[model samples]
Target: MAKQLIFKTKYTEHLKEAVSSGKSLEFYKSKEFVYDKKQVLIMPNIEAFPNLTSSLDIKDDFKTAVQIYEAFKGLEPIQASDERFWTYLAHVDLFLYMIERWPEVYVGKSSNPSKYLLDHWFISSSAQSSLLRHAISGLWWSVYLSVDEAKGENKYGLTKILFRQLDFPTRTLGTYKLGRHKEAVLGILEFIQENEDLFKTKFEDKTRFVTKHLNVVGGVKPIAYYDRQFFKSELEKVSGNISAI
Candidate 1:
């Protein structure tokens, strides 16, 4: 018989904790929010996904959940109806498990009470598989395991795209994006493609160099050095694309 995979109980607890500490429903009135691409509000709670089953999307989804809590007291009804929402819930289940059993997932500490939630693997299982079937395939994981310093604000850049109805192709955007801002991230890719010499000398060489001289904890400066040129080229290439902004 095939073994069953269940979402650990702690995700619900974390959800509850997020609600307790987040902004009240009334606070959302001051901001504008859209529900399922329909209902609009003054302030809205938004969730983002990379449309995948990897750690990148999982982390992005958690950020989305927290953002929604900040703008509204309760989750909008439409979110539950959207297929992506359910998809994310499943990914988080895996992430929650990874957080408990694997230490590397916890990159930084936060004072937020919701961060403390944990789970224990209750089942005796081996080599679990991804739940996402249609539309979403493979276990969503971060392709860029290591961070780059000058690659713009990758976290924020990723957040901006995920929150919106992705304008570009998911496959294109998913190809190792960089930058704190949209221009920066898109620019890097554009630049790398435009400048072949830079790609070989600056981009490829540094990738090898940084991969060697790296420490996920303390290698910020070196990462920045590698990313600087690509970021600049990224800026010059697609500077006029209105949709990118």
Candidate 2:
């Protein structure tokens, strides 16, 4: 267990500028961009946090999310949303993980490496889209939104389903407002779990349909105020429709 640390605001901005202007490319190539001790601020009253591990498959995001959530389980939503905290992790403790997971950015395969760095290595905003897009914070938020204690031993069942593929979190949930609500996310996952056969293939297309359908329903109704059951029922309405196509 170690004390949590975050980048000082000025350094955070400086790093962002460095990445954006392509000044950090050589450092990335050399694998030598280490954070200066003076640039970090230790968080008060927080401890027992461990460093994150890197994995090759997108499915491994579930494990990474669980690891991060357990380490910082007590974090308030506002604190978790802070860019300083996530940026520090991205640039420091999990720097290798970022490089391993996003090798294209460093290898120059990405058409716009600067934008890739800015998007994945930094927290762009407190918005759901931004939180879900960041390489590290996105993993934490995925578990945060979907973990259900009532599931007892299978608390992360929905989390597993969400990471069964990368697109569900990065594309589907990140792009939609419905993802901001826990109930909606759990409901969608529940629907998928209940009808596993339907989603065994074409998972991305079906999940996108589910989110779009629910978003339309949310427009006419206070879907956010409802529970997970409401989302399951709404999804069921389109189950037959999805099966036909």
Candidate 3:
């Protein structure tokens, strides 16, 4: 059996109470644990593994929390099925409360994200779709794959532009469909970043354009097998006439 956090579905209520009382996170502080900084981390008591929402970190800041979560992914030994996500949802959801409560470094949205966040916390039985719903799980996976050298020598730099591109991070990060082809996503991001000078469309527009190209190309070829050069070419052709570069 997969590790479970044993929250007994207290997640929604825990968050509800915390926000309802307007309390500082002092009451929610989790016990600190050292991150191994390896490809993965092991936390038998995942609940006590530190809070991602806390502005405070045992190491430093929010990014470190992200790093720790990414490492945890490798260690979790989860299966791809929807069932696996249920086992770990409580742990992941609890950690994200810190981010939602004190979103300065992370959420980048309104003070009370609960309006939108609650709906996403978890959907009916769709773990595949829940990637967008669960705060920690979605962002952690996105950052993990984004930093994992899909375009050689660590193109994690792309996230600076990628995440800022409106719904791009929320949509792209949570999506495992295109994720199987990381190079394709990286190639699209690389093109968007480089051509930011020539095109001045809304981030949502850019997302649509990229999604269209991906749907076409990904449907044609098994994108995971392609190299950077091939992915770039497909991105270039779909994007069309780069007058600047």
Candidate 4:
């Protein structure tokens, strides 16, 4: 029989009671939104063995924990033939995939470069560091992939969606605020990537015009109104004048 591992936080019994009584969200949000730099971290554990060739160096535990937790929350606990098989691959694969696929998902190293680092995951200096990092990376990658200067969406409406998505970080489109929007963004990115050269040339040539439109749309605060006709027209104008410089 495979051993079942249950997870728990080090929060005290009183904190747990308060959390269970619906006070956790406030604490969570407060801690997340207003935190100091000199705070201790709390995360999952990593079991890394030394590779004799490279000597003994510790790996990141926080990242491994978050990835595993995120994946688990996404995948859930499964009663498989082998328990170890269920977790080991899922944990490693989750982190590797996030790091490799998303340009914005950065894994930080220890401050002391000379130290043999073991912890992969790090608590942000502030309470909101985790949320901020995740949000920034997601927005950057999404914007990088979706904004097509060549085939600009109908009035930069697409751009507005991305930025608003960043600002709100809500869960309307099946993505929680500051969480991954893997499939939707992936689809858009794939389309943009396939036409990289074409789009790049267009964006570069009409930098001022394209940037103007982007700023206007982004600067529109809440982005309450988006005119499709304007987006289509601007995109067309920019697209037509691009050259492979």
Candidate 5:
């Protein structure tokens, strides 16, 4: 285990500039880029954690999400949201993973390398949407949201449903305000799990319909005050409309 570290705010700002200017493009390919002592600070009182491996073969986000969550499961929500910590990992520990997973951006093939770099490598904010966009933190947050302690051995059942497709989280959950509430997310996922036949076909359309419908429902009722069971029941009411979609 190594000490937990985060880039200093000044260095994070510098890194953002470097990403925009394309000055540090080659640096990302290197085995290691040495940070100046002043550029980083270790977190206090946090237990040392294992360094994430940059394995090119693991393309499955669900598996990677589980791995990432297990590794840094100790992080509090506030720390998990910190841009400095995630930015540091994106550039350092998971740099190769980023390059491997999104090679087009690194190879100058991406039309918008600057935007791609800024989006994937940096955590733009503590917002749910921003967190989902980040390459590393996205994985952690995905698992964090869907893993259920009450499910025992089948804890990742909902996680599997969430990551069943990339668009579910990116387009459906990330785009909607209802996703910010854990109970709502769990309810939506549980509903899908309970009726896989309806989702197996027209999954995107159905999920999009469900999320939009739930958002509309939230307009009248205080959905945030409800639990997963409430979300599940609400979703069941719209299952017919969802299926038609």
Candidate 6:
């Protein structure tokens, strides 16, 4: 059994205790959090993930991330209010597990949790970059979006295209406008994948462009009712107007 702490009842209360020390690198291995031997299970088989992160597609890895997300899906950690979500991610050893697997994650090998892991794993604001912010949550959301995109009409998986471009996930995934809606997610990715040449170098906030157009067209008709052609035309319209704005 790995040495670590876990929450039994009060998540927030336990989180306070864990961060109270504000420790890092060495903190990960130290005797602090009361390891209950029954905390929420983290994503298994992460040995290949560090190398996988280097791959822009992350499709296979994203699938693995989904497996992790399902573990927490209806569980208290993710089922609770959005704000308290971090409490579970941080306490769950998602950070420590990574560090232990790859000590390289430690910024300076300083063994200080606050210095290296805290900022990325524990964020207060869900900004545009939040999709890539906290380590574990970011993985889950990325998988969520990518899974939706794969379900769309496009035969070529967009995970490779979208994950490679930071512009896609950062500007859009955290927002309720498109990220929360499967139809919008699939439509936009298909639009982008089909128009690769048009946006090869002209891209700037492509995700936002898709969301903006979705709102406009969706207002006129149900987004789910729109076909592939509609997604293409509306995205083109939005892309054309982006330069004016």
lDDT scores of the candidates, listed in order: 0.31, 0.81, 0.48, 0.31, 0.80, 0.50
- Candidate 5 residue pairs that clash: none
The regions of model 1 sitting more than 4 angstroms off are 1-158, 167-169, 175-225, 237-245
- Between candidates 4 and 5, the TM-score winner: 5
TM-score for all predictions? 0.23, 0.92, 0.58, 0.27, 0.92, 0.57
Q: Write the per-residue lDDT of candidate 5 for residues 1-245, one digit (tens) a residue.
A: 45778899989999889878988766655556555657888977455444466432356888778877887888999899899989888777776677878677656688877788888888777788888878888888888878888999999989988988877876578658887888898899999988989998877778888888889999999977999999888888877888787
- Residue 91 of candidate 5: its Cα lDDT? 73
RMSD values for the candidates in order, in angstroms, are 17.6, 2.0, 8.1, 14.6, 1.9, 7.0
- lDDT tens per residue, model 1, 185-211: 344444434543443433333332222
* Pairs of colliding residues, candidate 3: 53-98, 53-99
Model 2's lDDT to the true fold? Answer: 0.81
Off by over 4 Å in 4: 1-120, 123-197, 200-213, 220-224, 227-233, 240-245
- Of the candidates numbered 1 and 4, which has the greater TM-score value? 4
Candidate 6 error regions (>4 Å): 1-6, 9-12, 20-26, 29-97, 100-105, 109-119, 123-133, 148-156, 202-204, 212-229, 242-245
Candidate 5, poorest ten consecutive residues by summed lDDT: 48-57
Clashes of 2: 0
Arranged by TM-score with the best first, the candidates are 2, 5, 3, 6, 4, 1
**4 versus 6: better TM-score goes to:** 6
Candidate 2 lDDT, tens digit per residue, 1-245?
A: 56889999999999889988898766665454566789888887667344455432344677877888887788888888899999988777777777877888768788888887888889777787888888888888888888999989999999999988777887787568888889999999998998989888788787878888899998999866999999898888889977765
Clashing pairs in 2: none
Q: Give residue 199's error in model 3 in angstroms.
A: 4.9
Most accurate candidate by lDDT: 2
> What tens digits encode model 6's per-residue C-alpha lDDT throughout 28-70?
5542334445544343322212222222222344454555554
